[model samples]
Target chain A: MSNEITTRMGDGERVLFSAEEIREDIRVGTAQAAERAGIPALSAEEQEKLFDIIADPSRIVSVQPGEEVIVSDDGCSMSFYGGQDGGGVGAPLSRMQAVLTYERACGADTTSLGHSDYSFKPVKPIINFEANDYYNTSMVTTAPFFYGAQPNLGLYFQPDGPCPNAAELMPMGKIDAARQAQEEAAGHLTRDLVFVGSRLADVGLEGLNLDTSGSAGDADFLAALNAVARLKEKVPDLPILMGASGEFIIGMHGEVEYDGQRLAGLYPQDQVKVIETAGADIAGVAINTTTTESLPWNLSRSVTFMKAASEASNIPVHANVGMGVCGIPMMEQPPIDSVTRVSKALVQIGKADGL
Target chain B: MNKEIFESAADAILRGDPEKAAEVARKGLGEGIDPLTLISDGFVPGINKVGDMFECGQLFLPELVKAANAMQRATDIVNAAIPEGEGQTRGRIIIGTVEGDVHDIGKTIVVSLMKANGFEVMDLGRDVSTDRFVEAAEQFNADIIGTSALLTTTMEGQRRLEYKLKETGLKKRFKTMVGGAPITQRWAKRIGADAFAENASEAVKQAKALLET
Candidate 1:
């Protein structure tokens, strides 16, 4: 008998990790290669902790019934600090497969599941094409189990900055792409909603420092809002879920001003006003950063932010957690702890009581 | 100092118009205003204000990038006026996104903030190889090397760079800082890095502290 590790990713991507390769990784290790690459290396404890959590499913915190769980297709965590591109045991499966697996674990109906895709580069035609492909494919795979589920498909992108070439394939035109994407998904997916989030590479809106020159931050915010509204107009009654970075939308508690001038207030009341004005059907608070890694410093406040958004929004508000990215368990904590923290936040802090 | 020229320079940057900022710089120079003073009084203040707003969620990336661009344009004009060695900069730093990680929004912010804080930064862009960091660091004689990895997988590039530096005995010569979403202080300490920053603002503070030490 031979011990083998085989993982399937994406539609057709398959990775087979031989025992020898695994041994080689252990011997040479990410630490040495990380050093050679001029990147940070996890300590021995951190390394052991990640493996332990991934190997044990029981460690993962279970989600309560009726709590909304949105699974993302971001491969950021599956890379596992260079175990080989989506090759390690911890590597993530393809987007659709990963979401289905996650949905099953949470006991969520396929129809009720929320699907997210990351447009790594955000090229206009390419991303739009991919979104269409993703939506149509989702309809096919999920149709069997789609009963009673309020299915969702979303794209993470930012408006392309001002481009002189109107015909160029840039992100600035994501709204137009959204309409096309919806059209593509039409007749394929039934009872589907749409979600749009900040596509900026680093942090979401909160991490975006305000451009003093002409209120660029406000422009982006309004642009996103307007795009969603337009998307709604095009889709006509199709639910639109606005992805709000907890840091910006909810993190802004109290009066926030730059240089003593009054600006957007951090109150949930104020936050809801913006969402309402955007005409979104729901607000999806992103807890991916907080539940996984505290990249933006104030990630701990994610739950509080979610609570605020939920209280303020007239529409349904849910929190999203990126399991693979955050659940890799870099600290002394178990990966399951990450899962537990997120589910707990969704239930306790997010006020996502069973519907 | 007409003071209005300074105000105009700041306003240009605030408007995120590089051409206008450069024009303001040129006008100031024509009027016999001190070029450095124009930067100190006008461009720097404007960009800093933008940073403040951005940190508080009043701004976004496109505007921030524009303002940074405007500031750079004005600064270039001001720098050309000063004799060699007259420009005041904290130190030269080489920064980039690690290999396999094309996400550079964080890295871009860090670069802009570092510049705002008086550091001369050489941005190598994203998905950079390890050897490139060393080569650039050596070629430029940078005082610090900063690597950003938004992905856990690509983060290995940071560690690999660390190992390569030690292997080449260049570890002691340069300071290393790591950051991104997945990076934590604990991970930084474990990796033997000099410092860890959670955001662009902290990256500046940490880089300055590391250089001072």
Candidate 2:
């Protein structure tokens, strides 16, 4: 037919590949599969022309009713249909060994550095931050600390989940009832933790400002201590690695300078307060995402959180920027980055507070 | 002397006052100033100052975004007056926050910057998919496919899209670009991508270069 450049290169029309949208695409693709059965969209006579489109699209690029497309890069290594078996959405979930599984298996063709194997790292820094929100959410994580080691980190979700693992507000009424049925689901953490209702009777602190110099600080510290109390009651000598369950608390979803954070020498002090009150043995810290800061602030805050936690807690905090940075199952893009390193920041904070 | 205009413009834009910034730009433009000079010396300087403040514990995200918006508003005025066909189409780019990740602010900046630069943008929104990217690329004939991930879980989705593109033979058809929180240029190269941009500004430049190359 016509050999010309069909691509108009309109307003940034480049496709952004993602996994979430892929799942839906397969559904639509499978519908196309059912319609076409086995008729090839690229005809025997048009094979050369089809390859021409691969190199340049001014040729015959068509969708013959329900026929699927066979795409390839470089016009050489062509894989049939939307995927290997002409399966679109159902390809991943097919009974005959998933196409994704095959792609993940690094055969002779596996040349990528990220991995074809859907790798799941078992060991990575597991950080935690205390989120002020009543609901459990995944605050964005970033890498200022462990800056060079972005891929080496993994994120985990062990929020200060409700006793029934329910968020603070939801009707956990079913929690107690379901607990007996699923013994494994029964939670063991201490409950009804207390936080300061107001700033000190002396300090200028007032009304829920999160600075450590106030009543709200005292309340948060007391609450952390409560967790320690329960842990101590269970095991008196066990070294406790107190976790911060949040993102950042600087601004409203924290984004400004006044809302930004500084590394305080004494870190994860909320947990420290709990351990001190219970007279429990403190072990390590889990530097985590901030409550207010999402992924945008992840890298910077990850370092800051680690610094403060280590300064105050006097413990090795596992900084987790990789978990939040990758934006994996979400953006499908790699994580955002920062300039500092977690361990280095911790050491610096050590000097700041004469630690 | 030019720095004075830059500072005032930057100040106005940072305060969410694009109108004042635009007026400042017009004054400079009327005085036989180079377009690029006025852009970098006046408008861009202000935006960059705000961006720097945002980057180093100085400014905040909302404020930075707002400032960027204001700067964009002023720049649009300047750009419109530059006469038709004279301005270059920076590049057409598609950007998105990948699947499962809800954070869209960072990508929003990239989109804004690209759009402001005269690039035609087909934003697929957040929580995009690998196949959807291919679909959009094929449908739009996109020159550069961009993906942004804000979480570790979500970044893996980018790699998946890459492999899918390869297996489906779609990888070579267009330039694959990657960025976001966890994504580095090294990772982009390792994942077999065309290029990796560190920030929104860099992303626009890189995407333009990618498609042109």
Candidate 3:
């Protein structure tokens, strides 16, 4: 149904998300792979996993790593080192190395997950607090480095600055402070995203990154423009899925002046421009967390944030119900049903708007 | 007083005013109402509406996530009111997105589910290495350790985890479960994993099942 109706972007980028096209993609890329192994495709109730046995040209068994180690997640009872405060990098590193060692040890267990290329390249776990330049346009776009190794999935991306954990909602942008954080993180962190990618390859996971080191509001908008310009130059044909957090909306929520009764109804119009200019084909907005406190509360804050943002953004918007259904009690495990319910409710608005 | 406060609280949430919603919920509690009923009747329905709106594309991720935060405040109020020990829960679990793979969406979902279900959850967060998993388990005294690897390359890390546990002799200390976009029961067995659940729901089942083992 959706796959056949092809829509090309204004930039002539062919964006294909028709029902059939998407189905074929799922069938060929994910479903077929599962079928080949004689396994059923994962249900929404099932987690997504990727498995591969790479046959590469290069031999990797010979090279030693920046550090040789086994990695495992066995719960050794490590204390938090306050990561970047420089209070305890050593313990975290030691703990991290042991984990990597266990990941290596997984190899000693089976030949099926083995790769042709493997190396313990000298790289430290790059930790940064911030990425200062939301509008950083001059930096060269570096392609992810595999160097002969296939990567693992998942991207543990550190923001250019400290990622604000939101228990409450507040603040449209954190640029200057974020840049200061990046400054502190610039050199203290040992590796770049590329290094992270290569390390992921060493471990056997395909590396993925949701690059959102950009700040929110004006600087974020400028940052978006810069990133989009760079992406357009690098991969003009690429179809992008924009991931926006509800920073500004929450900021609006927490503005002491706004009445609690009506504040959620107000939306940040500027952010819509920022997202649209980012040149993404789709947008997924996540704005709250149980960790950070920009707002006074947690769960229901997402509704106003999502609604206002939806009314504002021109691109296809998808809401992220971060801790909603999972927040529901008696439900042992929140299914995709967490966001499904919210998305269902959000749709009624589209119907009302005749969209 | 019944639907009006709930609807208004929900409206406050949709308007992005969680403090107001919290205040409203607090007002209800002050009026001598049941906290459990407030949540079951008031909060859940509001969130359900938000969820529906999100599914319809009327709301975006940022909006929904924020509302989830707003709802968190409301939940905190409600949960605080619910007398302890009677809260519905299974047990504690340690979860991470695995080393190298940092897609936190699904992992976060699992963590939230654990918390909501009344299980103490120590989220090692994303791109967690094996040591941290072990350390978190030991520190949190977690009974179940769940690792997620969304990449094919990284699933091998999950595979390595089993052997690392055996080598360290920590295999018996905790029940190790692996899943992601690429993990399967065969891979789970090949790597000597105790269990593999398809998604978050299955993850809960597996986590619960392992505790009994």
Candidate 4:
């Protein structure tokens, strides 16, 4: 058999690397990431298996017949959200119709039915009794086997309402004012999450995704943690999936802290701990893709991070795999070669419970 | 100009201390330093250093953004002191995230870097419509119009903006630029944009080049 393995770079450029070199990178990278995160590294056997999976000659790879794991997706119906005016072509399906399509047509085990607003901040205004009608309708339309989900995007403090103007405050040399603005925004976001989250649960929502948590930085992350804590208090059994925006939390509010740990610069391994502490049932880990790196490099780094996060967390770990993250190239349509290899590695080597 | 005061101004920017940078600007102005001199000789150098460090991987996004905030604070104070007609920037630019996309951090960074580079930029914020972009460009009298699309679906908004400009017969009046995670040099060409940048630093360089041409 040929020793050469085909792969793509971060920019989706096709390239070839020898199996020996790919194995060495994966072995060293996973070990280093585990060491840095203070988590257990993948055993030598796992590393070898990962290398073998990645080095498979097929353009795309998948788990053997029975090795399939649970799958979930955030931000579904993106085309519908874009709408015709936003360049969406063809007649878009309604949100209810979209969820059914995902269940029956796409075979998604679970489907997230979200409004175009997506975030808790904007969804709050419409969440009053009127919002329940949509969720209730979704429940009736979707199949019983498919888990019905609702999503709340944890956005940063600004560019929405009910939060003080941090953007304006920061530019005016009002550091204290900006901090206060973020704090105020966090408070509003937490309340909104509790309000909307509890209401969605009340309508028989099976799962909730706190999608893209910490997009704003520490304060934004803190709000999600606080909201998750409160939501669990109200609905003890609802499954909550908290997904991250990137690998590291941006220190927008450089001094914000959560559960006595500094929130800024927390990587996937540490970030998952806080997710579990805040009562989330699933920790959705995302690794930011480096567009300049090779597919092997990015995949190795992503698996390394994912392995550490899975070992570090008590909850199920779902690695976010899509464009611009988790070894996927930054393209509109990511190639299956990279996507399947990364997904297989994540499941078999990184020990991800879901994707 | 007091050499020590200018150094302090630069030091504040390097430290990413917005309040201190603004205080230094006010102090420099009180001490008979020309407002333009305070910016050109004091704060700009500090921001330029930060930009260089960012490009070389010595700093990350948060540090760069904080430094940009500090530089902007100082610039605001200095600009206010200049006579209205005397205030001169390298060029005027209008930038925003295209319609239907809420991702703005990339565009925000570009705006910060553009402002740091002495471009008078009017930020239209995220989920901006094609009409708003054209109107803002006309209203701001912008030399260049830049748009960012973080999603494949929303990228058509960039193309729409291009068509809108062309339809208005104002396509030749101002240059257009496109960027984001999915954007590329080829996509820019396909969309009829004059320039495409991969990051904040490159955005500044491209904007500058667009103005010169």
Best by TM-score: 4
> Ten residues in a row with the worst lDDT in model 4 chain B?
B53-62
DockQ-best of 1 and 3: 1
- What count of clashes does model 4 give? 0
Q: Each model's TM-score? A: 0.56, 0.44, 0.39, 0.74
Question: Model 3: per-residue lDDT, tens digit, A1-355?
Answer: 2223332221112243444443333234324223322324433221111000001112211112432221111121111222221112335433334333333543321011111111111222321101111012112212111111111111112421233322111111232443343233322221232343333333333112222222222222233333443444445554443344343332211221211222121233344445456565444455433221111112223334444556667775544333221111111122332233223333332111100
Q: What fraction of the native interface does candidate 2 get right in terms of contacts?
A: 0.03
Tens-digit lDDT track for model 4 on A1-355? Answer: 4777777777676777888777776766666556555666667787788777777888789988877888875645444444532233334676666666667788876666555555666666777643565566565555432222223222544554655556545533455777787887788778877888887776776777887788766788888898889989999987888888777776556677878988877889889999999999888888767665667667777887898888889999999886777888876567888889888988887788999
Per-model TM-score (chain A alone): 0.45, 0.27, 0.33, 0.86
Q: Whose lDDT is greatest here? A: 4
CAPRI docking class of candidate 1: incorrect
Candidate number with the higher lDDT (1 or 3): 1
lDDT over C-alpha atoms for residue A202 of model 4:
69
Ranking by lDDT: 4, 1, 3, 2
DockQ of 4: 0.13
How much of the real interface does each model capture, measured as fnat?
0.05, 0.03, 0.02, 0.06
Better of 1 and 4 by TM-score: 4
Strongest candidate by DockQ? 4
What candidate 4 gets wrong by more than 4 Å, as runs, is A1-6, A9-55, A64-67, A73-109, A121-160, A168-174, A290-294, B1-12, B17-66, B69-92, B99-103, B126-143, B163-175, B205-213
Model 2, B126-191: lDDT tens digits are 778877887887888777789998655678888888898899998788788887755655567778
Candidate 3, residue A227: how far the Cα is off, in Å: 5.6
What TM-score describes the B chain of model 2?
0.74
